[model samples]
Target: MEQVPLRKIIHIDMDAFYASVEQLDNPELKGKPVAVGGNEVRGVISAASYEARKFGVRSAMSGAQAARLCADLIFVKPNFDRYKEVSKQIRKIFHEYTDLVEPLSLDEAYLDVTENKKGNPSATLIAKEIRQKIFETTGLTASAGISVNKFVAKIASDFNKPNGQKTVNPDEVEAFIEVLDVKKFYGIGKVTAEKMYQLGIYTGTDLKSKSIEYLEEHFGNSGKAYYNLSRGISFSQVKPNREMKSIGAERTFFKNLSSEIYMEERLNNIAEEIERRIKKYKIAGKTVTLKIKYSDFTLQTRSKTLPYFISDKGLIFETAKELLYQEKLKDSVRLLGISLNNLNTHQKKFVVYQLKFEF
Candidate 1:
């Protein structure tokens, strides 16, 4: 059997994207603890600057709690339009090197530059050049990781953060993964890490000792993934033109309420936001899902699939309202959200190209 050559993958992640953009547009915000999204009264922090992070402020944290963590933290509204404009500029730089680019979000992406347009053989040099071009074009910093596959590349990207890059050579892949902490593995979350710890699997070496049957018995299907990933084996490809599965918006109120009237008003605002997002993407969905969270931390979702696709705010709110009253209130609600899926966007076929380069 002919041996397959190694691939050259790079993962690029912007540093504090939202907060950095805010600082770039307003110099006065530079060097200060800044947070984008929400107010002290309600909502959640979308992103926090490096300065804010030192005070334990983090994304998805409640605004009131973040304020308590950092006394002088400044809050700024998220400007998605501005962030999208910058993202476009950065993506143009990536396309200049390779067409195989997979955007994970507005702030990060994976690029397969094994056979790049530049004819560059060194993935490290390409990563360096790409980061430099991104900073030069958008006046923002980016970190990169270059390796033989996406999983290692994603982990290496965080080794040197805030405008830095790391490379894991093909020969070094196994050893690098062996010493890595299980918690730092890309797909393993806190809960899974705890389970691994209970089984005496604290690092890649420990995890590799377990048999596939043993892992599967404990973690179900994910055990197979952990077994392979621990040995530096990953078959995931970097797919370009990734489809958007869904678009949604939600809000956490400062106070919980049992009044259905107030919930209806909140649902209207969320629907308007969803409509704006769908229109911006030029897509409509046949499914509408309403998410409710109670004060006791219990969560529930109600969904309805329409016969026809719709993007109008009026239709979205009406559909969510119908789902809301479809069942009785279990407890006082603290958060409400609306999401649209089963989009009209065309799904692209995934094709895997054989690797032709080796380090």
Candidate 2:
């Protein structure tokens, strides 16, 4: 008998997640540049719809700049609560296949389908199925990349966007990397790639020719990671760590709120989402945190740890609401969030938490 290895990984990234969500919920927003983010004079854009991109709008840019770039840019603040619901649905889909799923953020995740729950051995098929499920459930598209390793899989997923996919077979690994831009290599960000360019390392083959010492001299530990990734060698393993040392959810509103009625409504939703996730895992925590993004995009978080753990929605909202009121910022509220942390040790024992937050 011959021996075979079992290491299959896939990366999933939602295309313009927030903006897509707005389009999904509002028929009129499709095909139009939509920016979902802060509107305050000082706030920055959080998500830009595909339509908005044509005008050079982007997330995390000054709202004013995004507006100036496209006079027609329609700004719809993020509906985090709804997005979380969609996220939960997608996560359920992932769990149906593998428990070893790691969600890096609200919009991205990695799945270790090595020994998937569905008994589906083909990682490519699993990625396809997951992307399909996400589209069907959320009315938004996702891009997926499948490969034997995470780095290749991540790059593969990004190869196509706004609903795209790519896969890299193990045998074609080195060649797949050789043609990639140096910046596409794992751990190679814009700045680092510029430095690599200065070293005349423009492609995987160029980086491969350099001695380990040369790369180390230039990039430190990250250089080592880049070198390994170029060869399709990733030692990273997928583990479930969901209980979370901290649990939090945030949403940017479509319009800034100066009234308590609207703010409370949104805050309650944020609290409820946290509570729902906490209960989904059958865990509780003593600390409650409230996060706020003012009209200017200036963010702040305040938290308090109670004497005992709780999963009560009302209590969590109240604690967070009070915290928000205390801040009493002189600006409109653009975003609100709630979080739980410092769980009782007993909570950790019963729940097999899967960790998905990754870089």
Candidate 3:
């Protein structure tokens, strides 16, 4: 039987994307602790610079806590338009090497360069060239991970960060994953890591020792994924035209509100944002989900699927309004979000083509 060749995957992630962009545009902000988005009074940090990170500031952390951590933290309002422009420039650089570019967000992407336009034999060299091109083109630094598969590549990318890269050879894959902490696994979050720890699964080796049945019993569908990932096995492809499952916008209020009227006003704004996003992507959705987070950090989601897809702001707002009143307030609400799912952007039918290494 002829053997299938290994793939060459590279995961490229911009270093402190939002915060770095802020510093690049304003030279004075360089070498200083910077944060993009939010104020000390309200909102959360969208991104923090490496300097701010030294003080334990992190994305999704409340601005107040960030300020308490670093009194010198400089807060800058987010300019997504500018960030998107830079992201486009970086993506253009990736296309020079390969078209199998799957962007995870504005700041990171996975590229399948096994059969690239450049005919480059070394995935490591391709990753280096791509990162260099990104720095030269946008004055931004990117870190990369090169491996035979996307799962290991994504994790390896973070091993050396803020302008660095790591390459996991095919022979080194299994051992590299063995010693890694469960928390460092790409899909494993803090909550899942804690659960794994409680089960005495602190490292990849420990996780690998568990039976598939045991993991599935505890983690359900995700357990199967964990089992595979522990053994350095992942079959996920780098899809250039990855589907957007949902589009949503949310806001966290500075103060918790008890009034439904105030919440309605906020929902209108969020609905408008959602409409804009769907329009930008030229898609509509049949399902409108209203996400509410109480002051105590409890979350509630109420969804309504319409018979037909809709993307108008007025229509979206009306649906969200219905959901808002669908249930009474449990506690003073701290956040409100509006999302549209069951989108009109249905998956396109295509034949799968596997690109393999020559060797």
Candidate 4:
């Protein structure tokens, strides 16, 4: 097997992205506790400013709860269009350094700068330059992490946030990971962290001590992933605009429905939503899937692969309706969802237009 070269990977995350954007456009909100969401009883916060974070107000928390955390918390509705435009501007900056940029979301992206246009040998210097350029161009701060692989770099990016950067040299990878809490591992979620805690695995060092067989027995396929990640090894590459494998939306209803007529009505709305998303993303799939959650908490899915790709709203609704009624109901249905899959293969197009960096 050929040995892959040690690559320079940098993960760039904008500081409190959506909230920061809100603050940038509204100068009055600067240095004040602000949250972006619906300020209603059941409304959830989408983003919280650094000032709001100090009071333990956070994204995904209920708006009512957030208000309680910070009595004077300012609520601002999110403007996704404005956020998308800012994200585009930030990506243009990454292109100036490397073409291998993979955006994680509107707030963060991974850049492979192993071989860059500037001929700079130091990834640390490149990260510093990127941060400076982002601040100058967007009036927004970005925190960056530089390392030999994406996993470590992504974790490092959050180390010193709100306009800071950290770099883990190749020689320092092991020691850097050794002391990290398992909960801090990017892929370990809350549930997994609790499971690890039960197993007496609190940190990377503890995880590293587990034998592969033991990990596999405990975590199944994820065992190998945890094994490699704990040792600072990542074979994953910075894939650009990875293909859309599936597109779907689901909802859990407040009241479960037993009538087929009501179920079909909900399915129609879900199908329309899926079609809208497919059009927005400029992608379509051949397979149509219908998902159902029963009042008893049991779930089931039915799917059919079409002979042709489709993006039409009418056809999506019709197909979903047919799938919904294909089988008799076992109990009252609580949720209905539709998704498109087996995506159409698209010719990858790279945007050639480039704007020169002023700095």
Residue range 168-256, candidate 4, lDDT tens digits: 98889889999999999999999999999999999999999998899999999999889888989877678777667799987656566
Give the whole-model CA lDDT for all candidates, comma-separated: 0.92, 0.80, 0.91, 0.87
Q: lDDT tens digits, residues 1-359, model 2?
A: 21222368889899999888888889998888888875634356888988788788888888778877888888786688988888888888889998888898888888988777888767888888989998888788999988876678888888888798988877778899988888987667889889989989899888888777877888887777776766766766655674358788887666688887788889898888888888877878899888877876687889888998888999889888787777567778877888888875442332222323211
Clashing pairs in 1: none
Which 10-residue window in model 3 sums to the lowest lDDT? Answer: 350-359
User: Would you estimate the TM-scores of all the predictions?
Assistant: 0.90, 0.68, 0.94, 0.82
In TM-score terms, candidate 3 sits at 0.94
61 in model 3: Cα distance from truth in Å? Answer: 0.1
RMSD, every candidate, angstroms = 2.6, 7.4, 2.2, 5.7
Q: Tell me which of candidates 2 and 3 scores higher on TM-score.
A: 3
lDDT of 4: 0.87
Candidate 2 vs 4: which has more lDDT = 4
Q: For residues 136-180, what per-residue lDDT tens digits would candidate 3 score against the true structure?
A: 888999999999888999999998998999999988988999999
Q: What is the lDDT of residue 228 in candidate 4?
A: 82
Candidate 3 deviant stretches above 4 angstroms: 1-5, 348-359
Pitting candidate 3 against candidate 4, the one with the higher lDDT is: 3
Q: Which regions of candidate 2 fall more than 4 Å away from where they truly are?
A: 1-6, 242-359
